[model samples]
Target: MHHDVPLIATVAMAFVLAFAFGFLANRLRLPPLVGYLVAGVMAGPFSPGFVADAALSAQLAEMGVILLMFGVGLHFSAGDLMAVRWVAIPGAVGQILVATLMGVGLAMAWGWSLGAGVVFGLSLSVASTVVLLRALEERNALATPNGRIAVGWLIVEDLAMVLTLVLLPAFAELLGGHADGHGTATGGGLLWSILLTLGKVAAFVALAVMLGPKLVPWLLRQVARTGSRELFTLSVLAVALGIAYGSATIFGVSFALGAFFAGVVLSESDFSHRAAADSLPLQDAFAILFFVSVGMLFDPFVLVEQPLKVLAVLLVITLGKSLAAFAIVQLLGYPVGTALTVSASLAQIGEFSFILAGLGLSMGLLPEEGQDLILAGALLSITLNSVCFMGADWLRERGRARFPAWFDEFGKDRQLGLQGQLDELRRKSQAREEARSLQITSLIERFPIFADLDQAGREDLLMLFRPRTAQPGERIIRVGDRPDAAYFITSGTVLVRVSGQDIRLGPGEFFGEMALLSGRRRTADVTALDYCQFQTLEQRDFRQFVSHHPELRQKLLELVRQRTEMNRQAAAAQAEPVPALPAQG
Candidate 1:
């Protein structure tokens, strides 16, 4: 059954295979990228010839990487990254330097050529952009101080990538010492080649930025008008691939860079979030292809023959990058602990590193086996990074001391309201303890009462209202002697009987305020409707707490006057009605 297959058939085959592997990866709690890589390996040169069109696969994979980077740029806002520029700049640069040095040293010891060692070492310094951003978003940490610093640091990495993309090829070509440098078409000689490369980058960025605003937004607006998800997807795909091609062919720059710039321009608009949500499926499809293409580059034989070397390289990528990032963030003035914790979020090889290595191998800077090592290293690092993201909360809990004060309640500013925040958290912590205590009969929460309260206010309120829970049939309050305290229903319902007339009251509906405000005895009886909960505030506590929020000075008198008038009218009618009835009789 082995026969020639058309390009379409092979591509369709890759998609189906990619999906199946991605599904398995999810079930195993691993990153889908890993599965895609694994799928590519199975279909690669060393395995069965499921895909005969290597060139076509490579093209689509290139598109996939560009789109992935573009998506990254759109998701991040420049203002957010700018806030932590001071720390992010030096921290990211320092990590890159340290990781590269470690990588180069290890590669040299493993008998890799100086040129290949340089390429491999630099690759180790690169962290997975896809994984890092995804991890930050998942943890709701993107808005946290730590997340902000980490994202700024990531931007530094991306800028470095741009420079690296330009320089690495130049370095590799120099290493070959051959005038042709593996036959990459040069516009002229060495000077001309360097100038052309630099010019392409400049022109591509300038043009893409200038035109992207008009083109991308308009295209999306049209797709949005159609309201067809399929069209939106197709438009997204065309934008990514079309722009990538223009950069590579016309501008003579890196397509990845073009895609990234395109994303940046589009990010400044309102539709950025919408674009991210709607086009996610398309990105996933191509990104999987890109990852699998990376895996296909890995050679199992290389790892087996040099397990120690392979593992060492992997170690340098993971631990060395992590440590360097941690140290750098501290040196940049962030607390040592916060820096290290954030660095853990970025200690992996990125998808773009493989692109660089693949280009290096084709251009003769890196050996094929070195490429294999990179592919495997990327897989291991990405897998580990995903695990790190998944368990970050657990990690933070266990190693809270090692992180910044920013994660703690005391670390941040007083924006969320101190007493209220702490009290809320404490309540959540002791929910079970406060669940069954019957010291208080009734409880209620009214937004109006808490409108002026901060976290501290809530804590103060909790102090006033000793919380209690009641089972069904538990009597909460009785209309009798002067009520000692007013009940606030925190949750559940209660029965209210005013002069034996029943009225149902639920959460947020407070009764007995009339007695408390008027200095009168209880006018109604209240009882829990079901398994109920409440917080009771004593009369003295209510006065003290309420005075601080809005001192009763004049408003309290007004409220009292209104209540008195209503009660007087009701009482007069009740008394006079009896006389009228007697006259009628």
Candidate 2:
């Protein structure tokens, strides 16, 4: 009973505490993320209860970071980002600069080193992806123009943070921290180290861009063809983990960067949606672990011992950053409402802050207090993030009432143009989806045999169908040819000549299956009577599909029996023709 099971114990306790706190947080009308952090605090070494293994928690948390970043990359849309780039790119960068300077000033007042100040400032600059998305969703603004700007703003911050993570280690020694494998070099030597790091990252990106799209998608398609859900899921995990590990080991890049690129590459594949859906649960679970582990690093004493320091960090996150974002958006000629929404959205730090703090602490660039302050800021800001949204809304309503002309005149034309572009994009996306749905619907409506299958089965059948067309007099099947596929006529007619008898198949009818079912060559020649359209199901797919749906298989078998009897009677009558001719003479 005393066997060493730290992994199991840590995982089990983390989840249990997370659930309890998460449920409580939900009932309190706060984000469940708040509860997850509380759970981590309860299980942390700083707390009095049973402590989880610190090392094990850290590794699990690392995996959480990887999966979290991967999810980010998977959902990254270039078109969406481009739509709001004019406001988002500048606004986010400006806010980051203002927030970082504020944090650095605070750190200096506390007698911390410049390196510590830089790391601290950077940590407070970015907002939590989960918190902002959830807030937007709760307000039903996720699909709105303001929501798009906020999301695009967050993406810029994430990209900046990724580059910082890559370059931080290279300059760690120059920043007065212990070098992490990059030897302490001054002047040109330091420059070379930075260049080397950038070079490696570039190389890795190049390889990922070139090979990943080709290999990863091919591998996924192969696994998908197996019709095994578990295998497909496993393949996704393998790609995420494998690429991350490989990049870190071979290319000397960070796991976060590697995983992000992996997702970006996979996102280009047709399987991206399925891959994201299947891997979501695991990603969410690991993301929770990540939050819990970050909580464990927090020392509650910091809140009391350095109350002003914690408050200062919160100001940088919620106030300084928000004002900067507001100003930048206004300068870009956006409406006041849009500016406030973007500002409110950036008023909290989450995963990236914790990640940056942990890396800085490990490299000796940031003090323990810096990490503690970041954690405190994250908890307080996340808890208060909802209030920020409410405040923005209150201000917007008041502004609209008090200065109606100002609201109408400011950015009115620009706003309309932007809204028009967004509407067009949405219409195009919806049209594409509707077209695919219509095709599936038409297939089932035209062929009642497919009506028996459920939604998923119908979709699978659609994927298996190969569309084909033939002109009048075109031979679709030749006598004595091996049966390879069964064709369903969707338009016009096809003539099947069997044993000197001619049979016509119009829309919704099928031919060429008799040989496939009987394991023989074609017994008839099928020729198009007019221009025709068909959906052909290959022999392999047909067998597999019918095997899964026995009812459909039975129906096909019954048709085969009826056809065989009809052919037999025709042949028997042909043989008795001589007797009929003698009677006539």
Candidate 3:
């Protein structure tokens, strides 16, 4: 029974091999990513046995890139980037230039064309987002000052690559590669292409920064109100994927860049934490596919065919790029520890390198061997990236002990200043989280009706509540007045006057729902007995929430019925007051 299910076959083989190799890698104390890559190699066309569909794997890997970048953007705020801009901007640029120069020099010695050399050098200049994020996350340094700097540096490199990708085609004919006829090799056309690409990128950024925060949050809240976990998760994924896809299609930017901005926009919303939590599993799984897909691209024959060339490319990626980053950071007045961390974080090239090399090959700018060398270098460097971090840690410790002055004297003040800013940012983030937690806790404790809500449900309820306060003797509701909202008393007391009877209610009690449910004017007068706090759910919001949660709606209906009976009894007793008084006498 044969079926046309290449995608399923690819995904299954990829996962199975990844798990097996990943398990073995863990047992051997290596990064599981190393094992994942090895698995991909085994399932690749170059290896024996089954060959997974490379195209499907690549597409899946693209999704992984999109989601991984989105996840990173959720945590990385503009404030964090600005905090380390002084070091990140110049350091990243300077390091790229240095690394590129080194690559160009090496390529020159091999008598390659200038275009090939430039493409090769540019490919080696950038680091892998997936690898760096994983390394930082594993060490719990993603939110650290150094980590922010490294991430910020990577962002700069990504932006540069985006521009390079745009300009490369425009300059193809000029640089000895056949142009695809979209752009001219003339200087004016090159300038125009550059300006156009920059404009598109800027427009996309502006739109995301200006409109995305407003729109995405509102959409999320709307979906959240539906009380569907799957829908909310779907919505989050939709927003991520949609924005990524839209930005790329409309703005001519990379999908990774687009997804990143989508995340940054959503990060400003109150639901950011929940969104991040909900989307994490998918992001991680897809990110694993990214590693596997990368592995599938490796032509291991390059290792045997051009050993020295492969080694040279690996050196440029690992040693050359790292040393340049280290020197640039130190020169930019960052501490040795920071320099080491940033350096190690960037010791491997990834997605962009593959993209550039592929483009180069398509344009006939780079030879096949160049592409193979880049792939081999990527594979080897990624595998050894963990060791690079370990080495950096060891070197930092040794340096601290042997040359304490280097750590103490170099960039100490600047490092402290950056640390202070990072701490402030972290404190603000923590405070917001605590405030949200306290809100949920208070709601569950004070309101039994809300006790059954899960975290997402509680968060949705919180969003609907419009907080209110009333002073003593203030009439919150008047007899025969139209109901606008239902009030839940968080604190203080209120008196509900029905007929001649006064019913007192304290914290956790609520009023104003009877009129809302019955679709009539208020039948009772409610006044604050003392200073009061309330969470008022407006009629529209109340109906929407209640509709989504039928159980809660039923509970409210029951309360309304009970209140109606109590009112009737009170009125009847008031009417029979004369006979009651006579009997008492």
| lDDT (0 to 1) per candidate | 0.69, 0.89, 0.86
Per-model clash counts, in order, read 11, 0, 0
Residue 301, candidate 3: how far off, in angstroms? 0.7
Residue 94 of model 2 has an lDDT of 86
TM-score of model 1 vs. true structure: 0.64
What lDDT tens digits, residue by residue, belong to model 3 across residues 283-396? 988988987887887789988988999888888888989998998898888899999999999999887887788789989899888887887888789889999999999999
lDDT of candidate 1?
Answer: 0.69
* Best model number under TM-score: 2
Could you estimate the TM-score for every candidate?
Answer: 0.64, 0.93, 0.88
Tens-digit per-residue lDDT, 17-76, candidate 2: 999999999999899999999899999989997899999999999999999989989988
Best-to-worst lDDT order: 2, 3, 1
Which is the winner by lDDT between candidate 1 and candidate 2?
A: 2
| Winner on TM-score (2 vs 3) | 2
> Which window of ten consecutive residues has the lowest lDDT sum in model 2?
576-585
